[model samples]
Target chain A: MTGLNNKIHQALQQIHAEQALKDKTKAALKQKIQQYEKQKYKTEKRRLVAILACLCLLLIGGAGWFYFTPATTISIDINPSLEVGVNFFDRVVSVESYNDDGQELAASLDIRFMTYAQAIQEILETENITDLLSADEILTISVIGSDEQRCRRILSDIESYTAGQKNIYCYSAASDEVATAHEIGLSYGKYRAFLELQSLDPDITPEELQHMTMREIRDLIDSLSGNKQNENASDTHQGAGNGHGQNSGGGNRRQGR
Target chain B: MRSEQEVNKAIERYADTVRRLCMIYLKNETDTEDIFQTVFLKYVVSSVSFENEEHEKAWLIRVTINACKDVLKRFFRSHTISLNELMEQPEILEPDHTEVLEAVLSLPLKYKDVVYLHYYEGYTAPQISRILRKNVNTVYTLLTRSRQLLKEKLGGDGLE
Candidate 1:
């Protein structure tokens, strides 16, 4: 009888689980849509602001090289490159570059915390930036934290993964981690970090993960997320970021070069 | 008397339970998740005052069920179902009898609701009545009739 009961039980339970997972996926998709919409909204507002600012300037128009204005660029040369941590909850990254010419270039940010698939999907296929970005889309390109999950990355039990190390995880670019709609949300960066660690230390035993704090394991993983030598500004995602967000402030800004 | 710690603990402990319940009630994936989100959101917003931990949990469950009911209505009206299907097993569960499961899903939403709460969740008839706000007699009768129909459809032994 228990066996018979078990059959019905499993079916219903399976259905229940399926529904929840499906719900999570759909909610995430919807969240991404909303984020994109918001980015557009912010961009529109900024454009309007620029237009208003320009109109006032035009009203008092002057025709000289000094009067003509190019974009503002202030090159903040960060020395001793800072390693900002991308934790398990971060979703987006943006970079701002300024040169002496007052010309500003919003360089590509370190967004490698995102899966190649997801990055492709968002950067290429998707058009709505508002939903993917925040209302405070740094116009001058503040260093974007695409994979906030990296900062919060944890070393899961070794038995959980294929090899040895825990995976880097990131939350959705679609939803706000601090203000998500669902009780549970996806960690895209930490999740991938988990996988990548396993691949590196395929023989990483489970016992090594039993008692250590996440902060401790992050020490070992700080060198593996990307090539240590890829220091160009456009190459932010190519190296393992140190576990300190603030310490890397100056150096992270240089990642856009 | 639950302290602040106890309230937090209860939320952590029963999170899985509420998630499972929402899933069972709202068969559609989006509906189940939306219900779960609404439950937690309302819980967080309403935490301004609380008598005890039980009150908090009860509030969460009641809101979850009500929210699930709301989602089911919207889903039936919109008729958009089966988006990104993935199963979430409880800590431990039994094997699925596919035919029987199909027969069960085919029942009217009301009958299906009662059946899931009873068999899947292992709730009593009275419990189902309370959850659904139906009379116990009505719940009991629905169970019997639904079980009979299920047995007839799936050639079951018909004993619950």
Candidate 2:
């Protein structure tokens, strides 16, 4: 090579000799390689544990959701106006009310965690409903917006509840009829009128009343009032919400909003 | 892939060459050690099977060059560590040798690399082009320009 290249070569040799990898640096790199190999082994183990933990959490969460959530919601609207939510094991887990009377009834009774039968017994004993019920009066319990399976479960529970009880006949109205009643702004009043109308005429069944529209129920109530020549009968039916003290033999219980 | 024993031997053989490349690129112990560890670690873990010692040496040199480039690119427009910081102890050299070495280091980054590969490492222009992934003509042009710049900086003694 040339003189300059020769000189550079000599200088590079000196720098190379001076800058050899320190013994400490070589040992440090060897240690790092060993650590890297060990880390590779643990990576798979850690990832598998993480996946298993995630699966366990998912299973627990699914079981909790299935157990805690209500399987059926039974909305009883006999002017007492309460919704009883039953779990998979037929235990009442929730009681919600849509009106003032139901609110008072809900507060007076802590029926949660009781069996469906016990809860219905509690509902019957509450002054909220007992005051509204006459000896021969039919209690109309309707299922709110729910699936067919849940509706069947709720209806079955109510039947079982009223079987042993005396003078308490539980009639189930269609969920659609209840929805229509709610839509018409006088669900509880119309439901009470329908029940009274049913008891007056044994031919007019619960299914027949459930099928009738709100206008039909109103006309039927007016015609029945006229036939009885009861002047206060029309007032009781019309002013059910206003005259809470006048318990006019059947038709007048305040509609729950 | 080299066996563990082979890898250890290769590390001993080429560790100084990588250290020199890192010194030329980065001018601090921290940066130098970082590149040194990376180069050896790659040698230990790489799966490529070299044809021979020359191929293995060339691959190591290429990896070293690329590693140095990465370090420099990280701080390209930011602060550059000077060669003064790199020279742990000034080697007692003849005036010509010291002056030439300083002039080469003072050259631009691309030119400094080509000059070091050609002169210090005794690599041909074509070999440097392959190692640096540069065109042969590009390497020759850099060498020419760098020699000219060094001539100006160190007078006639630059690349005589």
Candidate 3:
């Protein structure tokens, strides 16, 4: 048995793998490894591209949101009650109307993306607005914002530009007050007039006042409060022009020069 | 993936053992070449870390045997070859050694691994059982039957 085992071992020892076979296998394995590395690289590159594309989409969408979001609102009320939304850059981003006449006026104006000053100028120069001004109608411009300093700057700029015009009142109010005004479907100007009238008459409704001009609402408030001196006055009334217009309904009234 | 240096070392060390196992199972040079590539390629891609040289040798032996069986199971290929093509340089083998090798190769497929491992590789029945994943008693029975068969093929005198 030992001799048989030794002979089997000796015979097996004589058999060695040729050098050519080992070389061929090493060459083949090297080629396969290269292919594997290339495939891995391509897969990683594809993943990186997908991530970059998603980031780019998020950046574009965020910029669009930043450019279009409103930071301050200017409510213009003179029978046709409407509001213009201004972005952080002071550009008018939206115009919304609360009545049929305001809708018609809004449709006739293309003030989007314009500066608030330009938009207000365009509104005052419109034929309908010019005709109303000539007939002694009151146009109230209310600047609503969270930032008091920014609102005051805007109100000062507006008062200076409309200094020569008659019966155009400019003031600023807090955003919370404007939000309350919007809940009842009234622009901030008409809402202040409504508050004044409500305090005097206690029966004046927003619906009853929606179609009335700012001049008419002021006359109603003056008539109910028995302050008849300001009635039929064609001069402008500037409401304190303080960025915080909390007392704008009664205590803030000032005769315009 | 194994490094190039590691793969070269394994080929140098285990190439003879793999070639001998290939001779035990396959009857042709092409099949032996196929088994060589298949076994070495598996070693290259395998993440198995061995504790020592014995563990690696056992793994290579098992893989070479399985690769041989897989080639044989392919129904499309022929398994027959002339006796001259059986050994790759038959001139080096003495007449007595050639007779002994031919006798071992002619053994039944189930007995070939047991005879080679027990006689030439010096593995006991229990160790062969562990390598082949078989019952220790079953390995002893196979070794007994293979010893009897080898004795009959060669002369019974001086045969264990």
Candidate 4:
């Protein structure tokens, strides 16, 4: 067996793999490796594209939220009571109507995306508003917001724009007061008048006042307060002589006639 | 995956041992080529780190043995080959060495690996057990049986 083991070792020693076999294997391995690298690169590129697509969607969604969110509200109250929501860029983002007449006016007007000043000028030039102003009907504009400085700036701009107009009033009120006004289905301007009327005539209901124009509410408040005798004296002053202050919880009336 | 340089070095180092194992298990050159490609490809893709050259050699031996077994177990394989076809360089071997190699290859499949690993490779029973993943006593029994079979086939003139 020992001699046989020696013979076996010498015999096996003569059997080595040919150089041709090793060359063939190396060529096959190189080809397979190249294919593997190409497959890996394609998979990585697909993953990168998916990530970029998700990032673009997130950026577009964020920009949409920033552009559409309202930062303040401007309520224009007359026979047509409605509010225009203004974004941080001073553009009108929304217009919400509180009455049938307001809804008609809102439907007829295309004031969205316009600057607040342009929207207000558009509203004042409308036939309904021009006719009402000539007939001595009162138009009240209220600026509603959480930021005091922005509200004051908006109110000053509004007052300057309507300086020559008669029977128009502007004021600033806080967001909490506007929230209370919305609860009873009223614009902030009409809600302020309701509060004044409720103080003078405790029997005056919001339901009764909802259909009434701003002039009618003012006359009812004057008759209830016994100030009808001073009505002509108040009308003599065009856009001055009305109380304009920072009203934290109520209307700071900027102009009245 | 291993670099081409590393794979080349491994092929140069272990090709002989692998060829010997392939000859002992699979007698045909086609099956030997299959086992060669499979075993080297496995080495290229494997991430296992070796502690020493001996460890790497043992791993290659174990992989080659398993690859040969898988080829042999295939249902469509042509299992028979003459001794002349089996030897790539039959003209180089003397008659005595040819007789010894024939006797070694004629053993049953179970005894061939133990005989080759023990006699030619000089692996102990315990080392063969570790390489083949079998019990030490089983390796010892296989070695003793294979020696008895070889002695029976060849004359006992130079037997231990």
**Best candidate, DockQ:** 4
- By TM-score: ranked, best first: 4, 3, 2, 1
CAPRI class of candidate 1:
incorrect
- Top-scoring candidate (lDDT): 4
- How does chain A of every candidate compare to the true chain A by TM-score? 0.18, 0.54, 0.83, 0.81
Collision count of model 1: 59
Please state the error at residue A213 of candidate 3 in Å: 3.5
Model 1 residue B17 distance off true place after TM-score fit, in angstroms: 3.7
lDDT of candidate 3 at residue A100, scale 0 to 100? 85
- Per-candidate TM equals 0.34, 0.56, 0.73, 0.74
Find the 10 residues in a row with the least total lDDT in model 3 chain A: A238-247
Per-residue lDDT of candidate 2, residues B13-126 (tens digit)? 887787667756676667777787778778888998889887888899889888888887886632234545544455534444566567666777778778878988888999
Ranking by DockQ: 4, 3, 2, 1
lDDT of 4 by residue, A33-83 (tens): 677678878988988999998998998998878888888899998989989
User: What local lDDT score does residue A214 receive in model 4, on the 0 to 100 scale?
Assistant: 93
lDDT of 3 by residue, A1-257 (tens): 57677767877666677788777767776676678678879999999999999999999998888889888899998878889999989999999998889999999999999999999999989998988878777888888888888888888888787877777877788888888888998888999888888888887788898889987887887778777676543243432221123333342655455
Any runs in candidate 4 off by more than 4 Å, and if so which?
A: A1-11, A87-90, A135-156, A166-257, B27-36, B47-66, B73-75, B78-82, B88-97, B103-160
Give the range of the ten consecutive residues with the poorest summed lDDT in model 1 chain A: A73-82
How far out, in Å, is residue B17 in model 3? 4.4
Q: Comparing 1 and 2 by DockQ, which wins?
A: 2
